[model samples]
Target: MALKKLDKDTIIAMVLVSPSILAVLIFVYGFIAWSVRVSLSNWIGLLPDYEFIGLGNYLGLLKDPRFHIDVRNTLVFTILFVGGCLFLGVGLAILLDQGLRGESFFRSLFLFPMAISFIVTGVVWRWLMNPAMGSRMSGLNLLFDSLGLDFLVNKWHTTPNWGIAAIAIPAIWQMSGYTMALYLGGLRAIPESLREAARVDGASEIYIYRRIVLPLLWPVTLSAMIILGHISLKVFDLIIAVAGKQVALDVPSVYMWTTTFDGQFYGRGASIGILLLLSVAVLVIPYLYQTLREESTT
Candidate 1:
């Protein structure tokens, strides 16, 4: 009778979760498997051509100069975006953590940008970072010229060889507040007693942060880096809104979009999509493993 009750409960639980499980298997994993198969095929054009081409699409991407530019741009964007967010996030979080007057107002002000979509942020920053010069200059260039800082003016998103770096600016602006919230949470979680103890021990504020606080923030930093890394990798709408589909500002997500949809190279597009998935997985999987392991131990 007891065994029967346990089996009944188990069966009921399974029944409750089965729909969600099935949906994931069908929609998420199912589409992933389909994409993998398509990536290995010769499915170019609007019509599906599932002729087995092995790694042809993959190899072609490797030799493609445009794809090369995409890689370089992605790397540049990721580094700038990630680094800028971390630096600004940490700085802003520290400032807010001080319990300054009107702290809540400032926190909300900083976080306001995050509530706006990346597409919207891109649109606004596009106007702000206008690349035009002289009489055609407007936006940030106009501000700079009026400030008598002509030397500070330059082509922002159209700057040769490093235009992708400019794109990172708006991304950093939009996400830094989110990063600040994460770090602020981490900072607040720390005990005031520990800080007082450090103070009693003659530790300077800088010393405490440098040694104790910063060391404790490793987990927060790691989590932020992974979150921002994947975001930078999958950036599409932001770049498109800011700079359109320019090759100088191209990333894999943009390349994949144009290749798959515009050029009707479904196989190559699928391959690019797969590569992106793998890149994100590389960062996410280990973090997930570490999180789960820590949770289980606790």
Candidate 2:
């Protein structure tokens, strides 16, 4: 009788979750398998033509100069955006940790930008960083002129060669708050007595942070890096909102968009999509492994 009840409960539990599990299997894994099949085919036209040209699209991208530029832009954007977020996030977290006057108000002000979408940020910053000169000079250029600080004015996202790097500005601005929130949680989890103990031992505040606090925040930092890494890898909508598909600021996601949809190179687009998926997986899988391993050990 007891065994029957246990089996019945197990069946009920499976029945409750089976629909969601089946949905994920069919919609997520099923679509991924379909995309992989599409990527390997010779389907470049509007219609589906699965001629089985394995790795051809990937190989072509290797020799493509535009693709090379895309890769380089991605590298530059990812480094600056991720690094800036980490730096500003941890700094804001440490500042708030000090319990300054009107801390709640300041914390809200810092995190307020995170509430807005990246598209909104891109649009706003585009005007603020408008690169036009002379009569067309407005936004930051106009403001800088008013303040008599000509050197402070810049072409921003229009700067040649490093234009893509400027794109990281809005990204970092929007995300640093989220990173700060993560680090703040990590900082709070650390017991206050530990800092007191270090102080009693004649350690400076900076020494305590370097040796104790920062070490404990490593997990948080790693988590933020993975999140930001994947985000930087697949940046699309934000770039569109800011730069409007210019070649100088192009990244893989934008190239993929134009290549697949606008250009209708279906197979090539699928390949780009697949490569992007792989890049994100490379960041995510390791984090998942570490998290699961720690959980199992505990």
Candidate 3:
């Protein structure tokens, strides 16, 4: 059969999207390939002189003490941030779905942080968490001081994992609203008749949600988890901005950044970058496969 001729408007629309398509392929895939190549080289600075080091960079990365710490920090951060966001977002969405009076107002307030840049969020949170200069001293401190509770302002970001929490709080605050919106849409997709029938059948609110609502939301939860994992893995601005050269709190992304800029170890930095890319891919691939399998069965 002969193919129909393409319309002028259809051809124009394809041309409009072609630049974006080309941009993603060139910038994203091209840079990824370049970084992988650099990771296998012994390059330094802007010099092109490099020996084929094979897996030398990978071996050294495994041996580095900081690499281990950064990995630990990243995993810990991913877990807490993703888990906290899901729990908080889903919980809030459920509450808001119950016909709250100012639901729109509350939603706007919650989403405001997501609109702010990560750099701005980090800077603002840094000011708010400083033991001496933060709201701990200025706002809560004054109120607590009157009650003789002066122990809370000593050092907020000095503890090991606590510092991680300190940095993640702002991130969670920013992104949880977005997750809430996702859950809200999922919740809205549920039929009201089913909920009413469940209530008539003597199912408690908790049981209705636990059995009926939660299972149906699995697809949304999986998608949100993948996105949150990716964001958490790539988190560098908040950590670096708040901590500022404190390697004690560095995650892998921040480690790669500091290695390239401060330590001037381009090959090692590229290697770290490649490692992080692999880590995100590892987390994503299994989930993507599961999703695709479920879709096929359905």
Q: Give the winner by TM-score.
A: 1
Top of the candidates by lDDT: 1
Which runs in model 2 stand beyond 4 Å of their true positions? Answer: none
Return whichever of 1 and 2 wins on TM-score: 1
Residue range 13-83, candidate 2, lDDT tens digits: 99999999999999999988988988898788798998999899999889988889999999999999999
lDDT of candidate 1 over 1-298, digit per residue (tens): 9999999999999999999999999999999999999999999888999999999999999999999999998899999999999999999999999889999999989889888988899999999999999889999999999999999898998999988888999999999999999999999999999989999999999999999998998889999999999999999999999989888888899999998999999999999999999999999999999999999999
lDDT for each candidate structure: 0.93, 0.92, 0.84
Name the better of 2 and 3 by lDDT. Answer: 2
- Model 3 Cα lDDT, one tens digit per residue, 75-179: 778888999899999998898999989999998887788888888887777766765644446544455566888775444555755567667777898899999
Q: What is the Å distance of residue 203 in model 3 from its true position?
A: 1.2
Clashes of each: 0, 0, 0
Candidate 1 Cα errors over 4 Å, as ranges: 1-9
Q: How many clashes in candidate 2?
A: 0
> How does residue 93 of candidate 2 score in lDDT?
95
